[model samples]
Structure formats: structure tokens, C-alpha cells
Target: MTDQPTTESKGQDGPAVVADGLTKVYDGFVAVDHLDLTIERGEVFGIVGPNGAGKTTTILMLLGLTEPTDGSARVLGMDPARDSLRIKSRVGYLPDEVGFYDDLSARANLRYAAELNRVPKAEIDSRMDQLLESVGLSGTADKRVSEFSRGMRQRLGVAEALIKNPEVLILDEPTVNIDPEGVRELLDLVQRLRSESGITVVLASHLLHQVEQVCDRLGIFVSGRMAAVGTVAELAAGIEKGHTFEVEVAARAIDAVTLMELVPGVRSATLDGERIVVTADRDVRPEIVELLADNGLGLLGLSTSTVDLDSIYHTYFTGAVNHDNVNA
Candidate 1:
């Protein structure tokens, strides 16, 4: 490891991870542009983008495996570049493609990792058994990795990352190539780790649904820049286009078109059979209910046709959103 200058501590109460203008340039081609991000302790933060959008590069920088050309990153209150070994001791990383000795049993593979992490010999057996059970691999602990399925291997990879009892776990495209059941298990395991152990998680993936399922907050990356960062609802509100809600109402004195004009935030309302579809800047469900009551309409059903991650991605990449609205 190359020597680097030490940085002042940001204190223990600060975020678990902090990237300040973190950039990486390979032969003048920018892989990751100036990026600023933070992940609070015990938060399941997701970094999402299309292929080559710099998600992996950013993760590498955070792990101190790849040195940044410009800017800096800190993990667990230590500079990644200068305190990499210390950071690695407390941080666990599972790459998209995790490798293990094919001939080695799952238990053996974890034993190897434990040795590398300098886990005490006395504690190795107990830790390995606990990790295997935590990752749902205790039954296959003695099975050769060569015979393990993709899902099984992925679970073992997670177990390997946990051998050191890391405070923060970083998974890169962990759900890729795994079966749906495996994906669910992995996500559940991640959530359990956070809830039970207070481990901060940083998940990087192009898979929107996986991120949506496990992450507390999400950062959308476009062309090596963080386009937006927030919860699902916050991102939806940042866009100019409003969410659409479908309402089924019985006979009413006021029609859908007239109701649109009467509501304060409703931008458009169209009648489709017995259902009324209303689009608005924000959730107008309460206003909608009041309007129905005032108009003497009987409400049968009400549902918000939510704005999903796909729509948010499309809007941001296609330039539908005014850049000023982006959280940066």
C-alpha cells in the first residue's frame, strides 16, 4: 500500500461512511467524477446506476482497493487511503464475483478467511458455525464449494465477509445470477444483520428491485455523477411529474373533470368507467376524500398508482426532470 497523509478524525458520531468529492480517473477517462455521499451508522444505503456508471469504481475507492485520482473517502472515521488495513479490519466487502477454493468445503473456506482476518484460533469454530447458521449455510458447511449452487456460493460469500465480525458490510451486485429465493434470503440476511447487530450496509447494484427491497436510502448515479439521493418518496417528489392515483367512486353530483378543477393540487383527472384517475404534485388522497364527501360521492376504493424506481430512472436519464430539482 502506498503511504498517504493522515486526516483528522470526524468523531465517532459522524456517518459510518463519507465520500467527499471522490473521483477516480484512469488514463484521463473519468470512471468516477466528483462525488459526495454519506451512509449513517446501521443504515442500509444503496448505490445504483447502469453498467459503467461508476458504481463499482466508487465502491472500490471506499474499500481502499483502488486509489482515487482525486478527492478522498473515509470509512468508520478513518481515511481509506491512509488507514486501509484498519478499515479492512472493520469493513466486510463481497464483490459481484466472489471466489473460493473449489475443492475446499464451505467451512474450510470460512476458516481460511478467518485466518486471514487474524481471528483468534479459539474463537474461529464458534464464529464460523454462527456465521454459517446466520447465512443459512450450516447444513452445507461440510459440502465442497465446487458442488455448491450459485445461490449457495453467494450465501457462503456473505459468511466469509462476516468472519471478522465487521461493522459495515459492502455487497456489490450480490443478487446477480442468484435465484429469486436466494435473493430474498440474502436480502433478509442483510436486514437481519443490521437489525440485530447494527451493521451498516452499503449495497451497490444495477438491479432496481433488489435495491428497492433492502435499502433505506438510495443514490442514483448517472454518467459518474450522483443525480439524486433520497428515499423513494423524496425522489418522486423531486420530479416535476406527479404521481397518479386511481379512485373508484359510485354516482356523484360532480364529474371527474369538474373534481380536478376543484381540488387544490390535482393537475389532471379523467374518468375511466367507475374509476377516476387523478394526477397531482403530491399525495392528494385526503383532499380527494374531502372532495368526494362534499360532492356526496360514495367511495368504493382508493389506490395510489405509485411512481416506481423504473419511472424515476427514466425521468432522470431522459432529462424529464429539471436539473435544479436534483438533490445533487
Candidate 2:
């Protein structure tokens, strides 16, 4: 901790991050290829791919932990190659496996991190307290890290990352082995960070459903290349009849199949069980509701139904790894 490097950086803004034609190679093996990405300030961006898809390599290149074989990136308008320290000062990273001193208490571990980051002496204790409470770990403040649960350690890892108040947070598989409740708590904390502090977050994970839960936009990676990038609906729109919606009525509206087809963007409509599923080019819930009402059909329910993410992944996750192009 005593030999830790200190960094001071001035604030600058454009996008929180931007990468153009970024590439990485190792021992003649291509780990990442021609990557182009832009993450706006205060946006939650998810980089989604399976293991061996080069998501971690891409993240490392962006963070300057690994050098790119070609192209470049700007994090907070600073080149990671030349200004990594400055960028690091303004960014926080939480890897899938977080390590802490087993013999130390939770508070002690965080204090060490605060010192390593050169947090102001006067502000360190207060910040640590606030963070512990926010992460739901106040009760475990004095508990030895060795005694903590995996979820507890993850919560503390988040607090440790934020001790310096970084503008950008990069989380690599933030939720992995935790329980369902722990996963929910962590995801909710991410939401609160965006809504309350307007922090920019970059989440890299293979969990499709979790990524869909919180990201504003997604980058689909496959075989060391980005196959596509956009919102769930936008990505879905690129597929034939990818976007869909569901509607239910008080009675059997036999005309629903006919009415939905008349709506713009609708490719096909069919009745399935108690619901009418409408496959469309975009969200047509408003038009669908109006259409139902016009035909004297009482609207019992209406919702934008997302395509199964596994199917979406199978469709886009290809060896060719080419995508010109989701509502989740």
C-alpha cells in the first residue's frame, strides 16, 4: 500500500469511453478484432458474450492492462496507452474474482483500499461508513473478510471500488456465484448508482438475462468480434419478425388476428392460448391497444414480449461474426 502510485486527473467529458477499430492479438492468436464502441456518460452499457468471446480482453485493452495490437481508445477523453494512470484515477474496476486480505476486517480492507487510492484522510472514514451502509454491509464492518459470504465480499468489493468516487465503473461478471437474492440486491445497487449519481457503468458478462435487466444498450460479442451493438429492441428489429407484443381481452376477440395485421410494422398475428401474440418490426403496444378498443374488445392486458435471449444469442452468435445490427 505504501508503494502504490498516486494519480491526479482533471475532469474532461465527451463520451465516457470511445474505441475505434480496437484490436488485440496474442502469440498470433486474435483475441479481439476491429472493435468500435462508444459509451456515453451516465449510461449503463453491457458487453455480452460467452466465455472465450474476448470480452475480458477487450476490457483489458480499454483499461490499458493489455495493449491493443491495432487501433486506439479514449476513456474520459484520455488515451489509455499514454494516460492510463489518469484514466485509472477516474475509473473503477471490479473483476469476477475479487481478492481481499483474509485476516483483515471488512472495514480494515476498505480503509486499505482508500489509502491506496489516496482518498483524503478526513473523508476516508465517512466515505467508508456511507458505502458500507449503501452496500448493506454495515453489520459486517468489523467482521473478518475470511468470515464473510461470497455475496458480502462482492458488496465490499463494490464499496472498495467506489472509495475514490470514480466516474466510470467497469464490472466483469459482477454477479456470478451469489444467491438469487444477492444477485437482485447487487443489480438494484447498479440501478441506484445510475439514477442517483449518474455514474457511467460498463458491465461485461455472459449472463444474458442479467445483462438484459440493467443495460441501456448491449454489444453482442462472438468469436473475438462484436457481432452487433444496440438496445434489445433495436437488435431484435434486425431479425425477421423479431419484435413482438402480447395482448389479452376479456372475451375471445377472433378479430385480433385480423386487427393486429392491419397495424403498421406488424408482420404476423396469431392467438396462442389466452393471448394474442403479435410479431412486429417495432413496439406496437399503443397501436395494438387502440386497435383492440376500436373493435369493442376490452383490453385485459398488454405487454411487449421479448424474444428468448438464448434464441437471440444463437441467431447472432456466429463464426462469421458479422452483424449490421433489442427492447430489453
Candidate 3:
């Protein structure tokens, strides 16, 4: 492996992307509001939210396509707003809706894009060939882009982003047009990029399941602002730690709650017909089994339920945007 210089050994120079109080306003309407984010090198960071949540707008600013109304942002130590050309050379972007010249062959389309990016003429052909093969488009290299399927086009778009082998990759809804199988392939490629090159990746998507699989850290956006930023486990532990569980016992619902109250770790217990749910600090499986076994209460089934990603998003957003007013 080539010994590439990393941001870590450089200390304060560790962050690959930084946004300090970033904001975008349009005709008195705020799109992105005082957002602060940091993305470290060699990490896959994910941003998630619903439609019109300023996810696309945020990415535009990061790519030097949208102007920030307040504060500032930098990619690879250069201001994207002011040093667009410099930043563009160091970062690769894949938009949510990828478009291409329909009449041109895959090879021809990539050749045109490569020239625009100013890739060396001598290396362009070989690089394009490698990228096409990497994305499973080698067989369709001579085929016109118009004949390609939506999934194929998406794969080509990914190849286009990697043409220059950028150090930082920014993708917006990369899995939108991809099939389930294609989604898996695309995700695997993304993981390979980070592992092989240690490239800092910024992925924006609504697929929380996919995000949870790849991201080392995540930022949840709501109403143009970041509502929460942390790892999956950290967020769960902090917000959902005190959640209550429901318990039910066959024909003796009241007895189940009464028996659960005797357990040392169980904070509270509630009963429903034919089943019981218990909420406790730690995993209640062992205690529940012991309690049922010792009390001679026939335990038919036991399950644990906790807050999921959607639940977490709602909890923060419902409070962040109350009665159509955004809170500071």
C-alpha cells in the first residue's frame, strides 16, 4: 500500500470537512440555519432527513454550488464558496438525479466528462476503462447511454464521480434509482473506497437501514438544521435509555405487573391481555425468565422493543419545529 499522508497525525488538521454556523436564506425564508458540522478523514459520515429538510441545499453549499448566507464552510482546507475550482478538483460529487447525454456511448460520455475535469489526456483512456469495469459497465461501454437502465445509469454516475479518484466523495441519495441488489453493490463499492483510499465520504440518504450499516457517525437534519449528531449506539443510549416496555401474561395480566415489580432491576412493568411488556435499565431477558420460572407463571413468549431511527427522528423534529416556528 502506498503511504498516503493522513489528517490524523497532523492534529488540528484532522478534519476533512468543516461547517461553522452555515446558513442559507432566500427572500426572508431560511433554508439552512446556523448548521455546524465536522467530518473527519478516513470516515464514512451520513446525513439523513425527509424531503425538503435542506439535505440537498446543504450538499450544494458543500460542493460550492449554493451560496451560504451566513457563516462559512471549507473542504480540504479551502473555502468551497470562494475556491470552487480548487475544491472541485479535490472532491467528487454524485447528485441524487444523475443525467447524461443520451446519444453518447458510455465511453464517449465519460471521455467528455473527464476532459471537463481536466484529467490528463494520456491517463484518461486507461482510467475510464478501469472505472467502467469497476462499476460493471465494461460490457456496455460501447452502448448508448439512452439504452441503459436506471440502475445502470446510476452506476455510471458513481463511476463519473470516481474518475479523478478524489480524496473526498460527496453523494446525495446515491441509492435512489438503484434496485435492492444494486444497492448492495453500490454500498460495497463505497466501503471499498473508504477502506482502500481512506477517503472521507459524505453520504446523504433517507435509507436509515443502509446508513446504519456504513456510517461511522451520523447527523440527523430537521428543518434545515442538525437536530442530532452522533453514532447510532450513542444516540440510542442517550435518548431511548429510559423507554418503557409492555408485558402481557396469559389470562392473568394484573399478576404479571405485580410479579415484575418484585424484580430488582425493573423500574416499571405494565400488562396487556395475553402478553406483558417490561421496561428496565438493562436487558430484562434474564430477570424476566427467572421471575417467571420461580413464580411458576407460564411464560409463553418474551420480546424486547426499543426506539428505532424513525422514532428518534420524530422525537427531535417534533420538538425542534413546534407550531411552524423553529427553536434556537
Model 1, span 181-211: residue lDDT tens: 9999999999877777777889988887787
lDDT of each: 0.83, 0.83, 0.79
Query: Largest lDDT belongs to which candidate?
Result: 1
Better of 1 and 3 by TM-score: 3
lDDT of 2 by residue, 1-328 (tens): 1121212232455889899999999999998988888888888999998888898998888889999999999999999999998888879888778889999999999999899889999989988988999999998899999999988889899998888888888988888888888889999999988777778889998887887889999888887877888888777665544566788888775667887889999878899988988777677888988987888889988887755676567667753222553222
Query: What are the runs in model 3 whose C-alpha is more than 4 Å off?
Result: 1-12, 249-304, 313-328
Q: How accurate is candidate 3 locally (lDDT)?
A: 0.79
Any runs in candidate 2 off by more than 4 Å, and if so which? 1-11, 241-306, 319-322, 325-328
Provide C-alpha RMSD values for all models, in order.
7.0, 7.5, 5.6
Worst 10 residues of 1 by lDDT: 1-10
**Model 1 clash pairs?**
none
Best model per TM-score: 3
lDDT of 3 by residue, 1-328 (tens): 1334454532346478899999999889888999999988889999987777788988889879989999899887889888988888878888988899999999998998799899999989989988898888999989999999888888898888888777788888988867889888888888877776678889998777787788999887878988778787765555555545655455377877888888877877765556666767667777777887788887776766676776566655564222222121
